[model samples]
Target chain A: MGAGHAHTLHHVGDSPVHRLPAHVKIVAAFLMVIAVVATPREAFWVFGAHLALLVGIWVTARIPVAAIAARSLIEAPFVALAVLLPFFATGPRTEFLGLSLSVDGLLAGWNILVKGTLGVLISVTLGMTTPVRDLLAGLARLRVPGMVTTIATLMVRYLEVIAAEARRMRLARVARGHDPRFLWQIGPTVRGVGTLFLRSYERGERVHLAMLARGYTGSMPLLGVPTTGRRTWAVALAPAAAAVLFATAGYA
Target chain B: MTPSLEVEGLAFAYPDGHQALFGVDLRIEQGERVALLGPNGAGKTTLVLHLNGVHRAGAGTVRVGGLEVAKPHLQEIRRRVGVVFQDPDDQLFMPTVGDDVAFGPANFGVTEPELSLRVKQALGAVGMGEHADRSPMHLSGGQRRRVALATVLACDPEILVLDEPSSNLDPVARRELAEVLLGLDRTMLMVTHDLPYALQLCPRSVVIDEGVVVADGPTRDLLADPAFLAAHRLELPFGFSV
Candidate 1:
């Protein structure tokens, strides 16, 4: 249904990271993130090792350095919060660049910036490598309840369809001289969202009918399930194993 | 041993109490191709829904291969009646082309080797063998329509019900789709407004309006009748005639 779809974050390639079965990559990525999160924020070098660990995978995956950097900007808001932390926090004042800054605040800011950036990187790397459908399939393979995964998969599939419909409705609105750019015209835009909701609901009804026509019978039949073997898991988790070792060392 | 499809005294009304079909009867024998003609809101979709047991007959019967379309036999009826809905987007919901094609047979508990064979055969039949891994989103409208057809064709149904098979295709796509439809050997009930498509692909045509059958005859005879076309609001394209 949503086949052949590559979300914008996904960069299609045949790199080793892409070649790994989605479930294996999913497990490895999950473990890597958990290892990073478990490290003491005071263990500053450990965060760099985590960053380096991701970079190694990124290099292996053949994803562009620039693409990862571009999407990792999602952490910018948190970065801004970190920047404000040194100014507002009041513990253990110190001088830097002709201004007094709290010593504890700087460490706290560093923690947020470093951990948040690494977290975002992990997510971007995973998202860029695995298609959403494959990720969901991997979740299902991990024994997630079937109904939740099915609903999520359908939502992802219709996201594009609904977006296209909204775009068409926007064009129709503009063609009729409705200027959507004006701040004062927010009413129409908001109203348009409501209309889009109604349209999407109706389309969902029709899609349900179509599924039933083919014998949907209240549950989705599993298809194209991957048979991930032991070797694939071992290979994919190697970097994660390294990260966990570094995290353990940080606790020392 | 029985007709591929038999609809007799079939009637339906929505939960809103709006009657859409009134005592509709249709019979298509095995290997026959019939065009269902109707204006907007002619209850054509309602009829198609009943053929697969999606909607229960308000007052009559819809039989496929002599099996009644009821709760107990719905799965079998659905397997026997492959419905390609009016919109490809509405029908193609799986993650990839191959998965969508395999959806039907898999629903009937057909597994593994047999399922793959059906998916391969169906995609190959529709000239889409190479696109099995592609998403329906990446395909053009015509390609999507063909894949939608493959999704149902994989079931190897006795009768194929196509809703508006030629609605939004360019000329070449339109002709290509017609060729695919013509090549299929199963009984077909194509609900379409394209008069020439009916002429090119189906030998017989059935016209329904309001809530009942208005006319039924050969495609040429039905298209050639000026009064019948006008009476039913069925219009041929400009300068096109039988």
Candidate 2:
């Protein structure tokens, strides 16, 4: 059940968290993120508890902490924005390291940094535990429009195919002595991307045709797990339930 | 019983005024394995599309299992006629192998028990029962082809049309696919450029050129005529014989 193509971040294992149905995990993750966002930013301990919750899941799911840390670097650009907030944000100023910084700006920066990190962490944990197909299924079960899940499913399926085509096109250009290292040689690269887009569009057409040939009249059939039971939901949502408790305590 | 596939006076032209097929007439009885030999733009795919209603017939008629290939019978026709496209990647678009195989049946409104049974039976037919949990992306070209065939088979189609099935396969994969195809006792129309594959798998061969069926004869007799093959722009591999 773990074959989600090679591009997914799913850590294939037999952990209880992994065993839980995808929709339940999706709900749990959603609730966890909502709790994180709802908690007051000043409740720094609640944020710590959120991180601890994620760390526990990672440990149980057998995902490497180093890998999650590395993946979380995708938010580094946001960190840059957060770093600048203290300098330009208009609020009461405090002196730190001989430089005047806004106290509210510091708090705002922490809000973005912490919330964004926790959000991304929650997503990574979900991604690592649930296969891509299951994630889409979870979304489907949550009544998130079928059209969105269908698009997501196809994206997961064809991501590598299109990437491989791009690689092949690059190789063909390189074989023809097109040097991409120079600034002036960007024309063909841009055109190649354009060509790749067209090719992908045409591929989409062919895939639709193939789907139709198999009697796909209009909507895609619900191909996900038929039912995710109440027991599974209660079992899976425990972490989010813990986060909710932490959030209420934080409010208190 | 009616012929498995019957296309009479079939014709098609693209929206750009490009004439792809012109009044093509063909019929294949039940259980016949016919190889469609054609050049790059000889309307083989266009004809196949007409078989399953992907392309509405521009001129004439197409019937599958005695049912007209029109709006009324499209759903049923698609169930009866399965086209395994040349590219397996284009065919198997689901996240997992089982899901891809199940896609067609589920679309056909086949519910559980029957749906899962078809998936298992189809995968078993292609000798890929073990890899149902794997991603089609991770499979070898041949394995992917087999799974693609399974996706079609899971629909319980009466006729299978394959487009360039042997393309991009190593010799071993090619032969293995041939074995699988040989074991399936259903009507098949294989569109291919491989003369040797035609000679090996199909007893009868149909040659289409310039939007028409130019020749329809025994595979051995057709491949034996070098001049005829050369005239159709089909060249047998050197030193290969029927």
Q: Who wins the DockQ comparison?
A: 2
- TM-score for every candidate vs. truth? 0.93, 0.94
List model 1 lDDT by residue over B1-242, tens digit each: 58999999998999999999999988988899999999999999989989999888889999998999999878899999999987899998876788888878899888888889999999999899999887788899899999999989998898999999999899999999988888877799999999999999899999999989988889999999889899989989999977
Model 2 interface CAPRI class: medium
Give the range where candidate 2 chain A is weakest over 10 consecutive residues by summed lDDT: A1-10
Best by lDDT: 2
* TM-score of candidate 1 versus the correct structure, residues matched by position: 0.93
Worst ten-residue run, lDDT, model 2 chain B?
B233-242
lDDT by residue (tens digit), candidate 2, A1-252: 553346447777788888888888888999999999988989989999999988888888888888788767788999999899999999799999999999999999999999998999998888888887888877877888878988998998899899999999999999999987878879999999999999999999989889998988766677745676788877788899999999998989
